[model samples]
Target: MIQVDRLTKRYGSFKAVDGITFSVGRGEIVGLLGPNGAGKTTTMRVLTTFLGPTSGRATLAGHDVLDEPLEVRRRVGYLPENVPLYLEMRVREYLLYRAKLKDVPRSRRRAAIHEVITRCRLGDVEDRILGHLSKGFRQRVGLAEAMVHDPDILILDEPTAGLDPIQIREVRALIRELGDRHTILLSTHIMSEVEAVCGRVIIIAKGKIAVDDRLDRLRSESSIVLEARGPADAIRRGLESVPGVEHVVQAKVEGDYAAFEIHTKNGSDLREELAQRVLQNGWPLRQLDIRRTTLEDRFIQAVTRETISAEAEREAV
Candidate 1:
């Protein structure tokens, strides 16, 4: 479990993280998404006790990140975007060393190292030097190091970064399996990874949280795609008149048929009303379906909307 309330971090006048608030429940795998320099790493650093927040408060499993940083660190395992690893050390040796550093008893260190090795799929290369390992294998080694202490929370930043497709899949599967037991907060630029592995997503932009909601619910919050063989203006007017329809943005028209996306209130389904209207008007309905929203769609919408809002605020000021 993790909670951050109005957390703010600044470097002089530049605010890296600005009054962001969110929580991760037990055993939940939440994706933290943002464009470059959006303060994702800054937020994670503050949460992990790697950096103290300039203001606000955060806690890990009820321990204050600032006041009880040692306790928080004990419970949180962090794999930063650029993973810090000892290149000269062997995989097993590196994990073993990290386990000891985390205060794993000498009696348990060996077993803990082995467990993470197997879980991270680093068994074959366990004895190989980390410097000699491939980037994918090295990434796994970094993960193994992170979990060597069996922390309750895992904070992984770009866990699959710079990996091949197959390696990315491997890391994703590993993250999913870990989520069954540990609370995971991962930051990634990859939308498919969030859709595939995360239950909820927190889209951060301009040092603020743009959207936070369940993946399935967000996907359902998409426009209704309608294609009908009728006059474009007439179709648009009919759709706009339908209750629950907010705006009907036109897509394109070919001959007598025109495609339009009907934005509805809270992803409401207006297909029945739309069908009735088309039938009453004797309009030929070619296709009517809800357009599924992807993670990319949500991310772009949030960032773009936030940018516009910020611009308007500046103009008002």
Candidate 2:
């Protein structure tokens, strides 16, 4: 439902986004991830029609972002990182106003506003002034306004930015519920948010695309965790000589138990073999479990690799 092709955005001599391309399919939730100054917001702005790309193209639901901006806007619901809201207005009143601005038919405006209020769980605060609401409520109000028009695609940037743990969980749950019906392109610096909600991840670094793949595949690329109740050196020696184990890094030695993060070749599962070795040696086994790679790991690896490659290119030039 969303497509970006070699898109680039520049401000004077600086390139905020450089030749990045990706797409979001119908009913898919994709996360756009990056550190600060990593061009994530730039790319989202170009897609939302707030900024034009210096060169290249982007389309939302078959309408060219540059040529059919109005049409694109009609199909897209964007909630920026800092949601712009009229604080003095009541929640319901503001949503009604946004519905009108989005060109929701006057005849159906009431229904549209009601639907979003319900979807965003704003029933209790619908009549409360936005300024008096908590930060979490205000965030929900912003979300309600964004989807008041029931657009085809939802582009949310940092949807759970400043909320406490409870509020963050609430917002993440709502986003997941929305994903069932909307083609969502989520952008955030929170790795856990992406891990919790996004099916695919796109990591951008230094104005370029770094990694784009399914979340499951990325996690499978991480190392395994193995711990045993034996001498640290003995455990390390046994694991090191294992057929599939490529590298072993000692983690800790607590009492009789020793822990190591085992990097195996081709993402192998060697739990059974490791346990059998421990049993053969008559060493007590404490814990032999997989510590699945997290989204944070994949993100760090991507950004670090990109930085290294960029430095190498600059040196060669």
Candidate 3:
């Protein structure tokens, strides 16, 4: 379990994370997504006690991040973007050391290390030097070290940053399996990864929380794509005049037919009306379909909106 209320982190005058609030429930996997420099890594660092927040408060499993940092660390296993690895140490050796650092009991330390090694698929390379391993193997070593202590929560930043497709799929499956037992807050640039393993998504931009919602609900947001052959202006006006249509924007022109994306209100299905309108106007309808909103679409929309707002604020001043 994790709780962050108005969490803010700053470096000099630049605010990295600004007044963002969200929570991850027990056994839930939540994706923290954003563009570059959107404070995703900053937020994770603050939660993991690697960096302190400038203001606001965060608690991990009921332990205050600032006042009870040690307790927080005990409950959180962190795998940063660029994992801090001891290049000379063997995979199992590094995990053994990490287990000790996380205070795994002497009796269970061996068992914990073994479990993580197997779970993270590090068995074959367990005896190999970390520095000599491939990037994918090294990433697995980092994951094993993080899970070596069996912490209640896992804070992973770019867990699959440098892995091949096969390795990425393996890691994604492992994360999904881990979610059954640990509350996970993951940060990554891959939308399909979130869609695959995360039940919820929190999109951050410009140092602020932009969208936080269930993955299914967010993906359920849909719009209509219509392509018709007619005067572009007339087709646009007709679609815009539809009762539930919010607005219509011409996507592109393919010869005589033009594609228009129709954004509707309240996720309404106005496809029938739109088709009739096209027919009434004597325009040949080429395509009319509802396009489900994707995680990437929502991510881009949030970040773009934030960027525009920031620009507007700067211009006003």
lDDT of 2 by residue, 202-261 (tens): 999988999999998987876667777878898899888889989999999888888989
Screening candidate 2 with a backbone cut-off below 3 angstroms (N, C-alpha, C), the clashing residue pairs are none
Question: Would you give me the overall lDDT of model 2?
Answer: 0.90
User: Over all chains combined, what TM-score does candidate 3 have?
Assistant: 0.91
State in Å the error of residue 308, model 1: 1.4
Cand. 2 TM to true fold: 0.83
Each model's C-alpha lDDT?
A: 0.90, 0.90, 0.91
Model 3 agreement with the true structure over 4-34: per-residue lDDT tens digits: 9999998998889989999889999999988
TM-score of 1: 0.90
For every model shown, what is its TM-score relative to the native structure? Answer: 0.90, 0.83, 0.91
Clashes of each: 0, 0, 0
Clash number for candidate 1: 0
Best by lDDT: 3
Worst 10 residues of 2 by lDDT: 219-228
What C-alpha lDDT, on a 0 to 100 scale, does residue 317 get in candidate 1? 82
